[model samples]
Target: MTDITSTELKQRQSAGNAPTIIDVRETWENEEGRIEGSQNIPLGTLPDKLDELEALKDQEIVVHCKGGGRSASAKAFLVQHGFKNVRNLLGGFQGYQQA
Candidate 1:
């Protein structure tokens, strides 16, 4: 799936149709700021959280990090693990903040 821009994310959030958003940053980084309602799953921990996330396999999941790098890896990891609809958040939280 194509990455979602911060602007596009904000629009969906405002409309109350936002997808399941996962913040793939360190816990402290996520505590600094995060899109409301986004869950923190930190990139490195995604593998450990697979069972917990199993129910969401076919659901649309949006992943973000401090910038965009980690989230890209997270998206790829989830896809490799049988996730059918995972997307990266373009520019990540920094871009979302700027937007």
Candidate 2:
């Protein structure tokens, strides 16, 4: 899986080349704040939601969570499931905030 820095992601968004951002954090965690336009799909529910994401397999997907761990797992899972353009948000949401 590829890794995308928060700064790089921010630049891409500003340039209007936004990838689909998937937040793998829990619902409560997402209630705090999230990158604009990101979709919430907790890591635990991802497997059951695979069909919902099938159409996006060929598109760029950026995954993140409260920290980096969960997103990393999500990225790996997507890749294993044949997602061709999946990326992990380096440092996750906290890092995005700092960036």
lDDT of each: 0.94, 0.95
> What is the C-alpha RMSD, rounded to one decimal, of candidate 1?
0.6
Could you report the Cα RMSD, in angstroms, for every candidate shown?
0.6, 0.7
Write candidate 2's Cα lDDT for 38-98 as tens digits: 9999999999999999999999999999879999999999999999999999989999999
Write the residue-wise lDDT of candidate 1 on 1-49 in tens digits.
8889999999999999999999999999988888899999988888999
Show model 1 residue runs off by greater than 4 Å. Answer: none
For model 2, the local distance difference test gives: 0.95
Instruction: State TM-scores per candidate.
Output: 0.98, 0.97
The lowest-lDDT stretch of 10 consecutive residues in candidate 1 is: 38-47
